[model samples]
Target: MEAFVQSKREDTAKEPSLFLLPEWMEADKRLTAGFTGRGGGVSAEPWTGLNIGLHVGDDEEAVILNRKRVTEALGWPFEAWTCTEQVHGSRVAQVTLAERGKGRERMDDTIAGCDALMTDVPGVLLTSFYADCVPLYFYAPEAGAVALAHAGWRGTVGGIAARTAEAMASAYGVRPDQILAAIGPSIGDCCYEVDGLVVTEVDRVMDELKLPEGERESCMQRKKNGKASLNLKELNRQIMIKAGILPSRIELTTWCTGCRTDLFYSYRVEGGKTGRMASWIGLQER
Candidate 1:
């Protein structure tokens, strides 16, 4: 069974064209977590899809309109929209009520160089833009806390997943076992081939993690061509497990951005200049 349920829109220009994690969101009525799809927006040309990222060259007004549409579709106020300047680093910033709407419209307003956003503030939606990088979601339901991490290869190797969980634990007194984790859509092993430097970093991270031989092999399938097919979502899942999130509690997405560019914006397949989807998690006010 796929974890991230696709909510398809008949019209490409419709709102809320996205994937929802029903396992987490439906189970907890107050929680909302999902990834945006490359449909139902007003961007043109290379970004003809629902480009939710403001940092990309997409028109600011168009991007904001798309974002506003998504919020309305979720029954959330656009003022609750919040985000960070994802630097593909391991830095996790704690968002408060005062920063609830930071970076909703412009780059200058975003929390600088932060790859992860975690918050216990109800109604504050924590969001991060992505183009094939793994999106890690954390929900300490027992503590009423949620987080979103942008795990590009650098953020992954830097251990952003563990850092976000640890931050949640420290800030909200959440036990690792009590956290519900989800891995969102990204480039899967089939289309994410890596060589040289990437392979070295992955090996180093696995060594530090002390993952079993089978697990290590599954994370990186080496080919005779001296390259490896990297399963980033799996690598991040293993990391979440090491961080104390239970295997059964974690929901992994089968949607591959690289293999399914029609549904997702793939930076690898799109020659780097492309739109970005948003992964968001927030606690609603009662």
Candidate 2:
């Protein structure tokens, strides 16, 4: 079953379309976790709708409005919307009260130079932008902790998944086995073709993984044209498994952003200039 469930709704300007992860949210009413879709925002073309990225070329006012709409839909206070300046690295920042709402309005004050954010601080909604790259979410309910990570191929090679788990352990004493993880919507192997540099780096990571031959082939397959089809989601899941997260506790989404352009913004298919979706997870104060 898909982990991210798209709630059906009209694409009106008032409410943005959302794909929610109820496995975490419903289990604990205080938690709000979901990914935004490509509709129902006020951004102009290229970004078009619901573009929650301030880094993108979308107008400042439009991007801010779109983010406000998402916060409104989640019934979360806009002040709790914390974000990161994603550099496609493995760095994870431990968000605290000081970092709360750091990047909601503009880019100048966002948490700098981080692709992953974890917080035990309630009311700090952690967010990261995406437009095909994987969004990995982490939660340790017993520890009152939640994390949001943005992993592109670069971050994947840098082992961001394991790094995130380690950060949670160090900062919150949350064991990897106790962590609940979800790999959100991203480019699937069916549409993610790669060559040269990507293929070489992926090879290095796979060798480090030391996966069995059959299991290895499932993650990446070379094509007749010398390009390889990479299953980033599967590979990231394996990385999480290697980090000690139980396979049974992980939920992987089947939505392929590259193929679902109507419902998502594909940075690859929608041309290089396009909008980005937001992956958010946080716990409200009791």
Candidate 3:
């Protein structure tokens, strides 16, 4: 019951691979929401194929080309490929038509120090890069609003999920119950282990959520040595539910980027010199 499914590619394409949300597609033809994979790109060596992040040590030209490939495949104008400079904070920027395509090529052009981008404007694609961290998506079709958030450990504890819901409600009058959310591919619990302060922060968030004993243990498992394996996707899902999104309305993906590095770029597996995949959502203008 994974929500993010691999997209069938044309025989000729070599870069810009994608995984799409089929249910979202069926629910609204004008909506496009999904994540990118590691194949079909112009980067060389460590980045291999399709590294869409500009600040991740990949060649700027190569990264731009890879991003263009995704825009082309989605039939969205490259001029609308917008992004932000993610700093793993819970800051959400309200994207306007004027902000469209701000960071498509130059990193400095991106919305500064923002990890989440939300917009009600049609045709403005919202995107954020990720390797192992979680990608949280939000859509309020009633208000024609969509958001994409980058939630690393810092952002997770900072409550980016709840901040996104609040931003949607304040900016677009979107009710949390009316919002549909999707947690995209990231490092799964099996591949993600942390200790010390990381554990402390995660536990703090769990406490805020008041997770039941069984659920709390499922969210974090301790090793004999004191490190803990964390389920980031599940944590974010619970955070969204606490923010008012129904459990049934959130689509969680089981595709762990760390476990399936063949299909994704995992910073953990690649020793921190890896590429980044993108999560994108937009409402195409009719």
Candidate 4:
């Protein structure tokens, strides 16, 4: 589908109800974004509570209600959320005016084969599910746009975060410097060990982009066993920087999913049999 430029005003807010909301951006009533930790949902064991992922073997009804609770907590109408079927690719979907209610009644239709979703439409929440994959959020207040991306090794190697940022810039006329990014909790460098193939791919991308020599090595440091420990959060942060976003405009969470089992579900720690956490961003209605 062809992407069109849109005009709107953007602001951001975050909640502090035990959720990992950003303190610096919580005062604005026009933007809402947060990650639901492993608490406050209705799924039973394995899935536990506050599991917002419907495809992760959680009870469908419970997932629905949990989604509702999250929306209600944000004071947004429950029907305004928009999510997608995330394929670990670099594709970014630009949400338009017509897709406002897709989150409630046509979720399946909204499940495009993409890793990122962006919108300038106010009150339309954009969401993505992640276990070990990094959840990245983008906002350009001056352009009135926001985007959410799920970046696993595949997506990272494919440059999904950069693609999402580029989409926002192209579609909303947002300067890279004006974009604010958040690197949410994920499998940190302390726990994410990868094979040589991943190391090679990451190196190849870094070389192709001519990323800073020190930054690249810092993200792909090796462990004693020769297996490289990948810092996805740092890699993605570099992606944003390469895309022209200023360092001061980015915020990162120090929580590691693999380490904080009580707060987040980690696919690596749980052998792929774990619930997924939801990371979302949206513009509130004026």
lDDT of 1 by residue, 1-286 (tens): 9989888656656765789988777789998899999988889988986899888788999999999998988889999999999888999999999999999999999988899999999999999998899999998878899999999999999999999999999999999999989999999999899999999999999998899999999899999999999999999999999999999999999999998988899999999989999999998998
lDDT of 4 by residue, 45-156 (tens): 8887777777777777878877787787767787887888888899998888777666553347665788899999887888888888999988887878899999999999
The residue ranges of model 3 lying beyond 4 angstroms of the native Cα positions read 12-15
lDDT of each: 0.92, 0.93, 0.92, 0.78
Sort by lDDT, best first.
2, 3, 1, 4
Please list the residue runs of candidate 1 whose C-alpha ends up more than 4 Å from where it truly belongs after superposition: 9-12
Candidate 3 lDDT tens digits, 46-97: 8989898888888899998899899999999999999999988999999998
Clashes of each: 0, 0, 5, 4
Candidate 2 residues 206-247, lDDT tens each? 899898898789889999999999999999999999999999
After the best TM-score superposition of candidate 2, give how far the Cα of residue 36 lies from its true spot, in angstroms.
Answer: 0.4
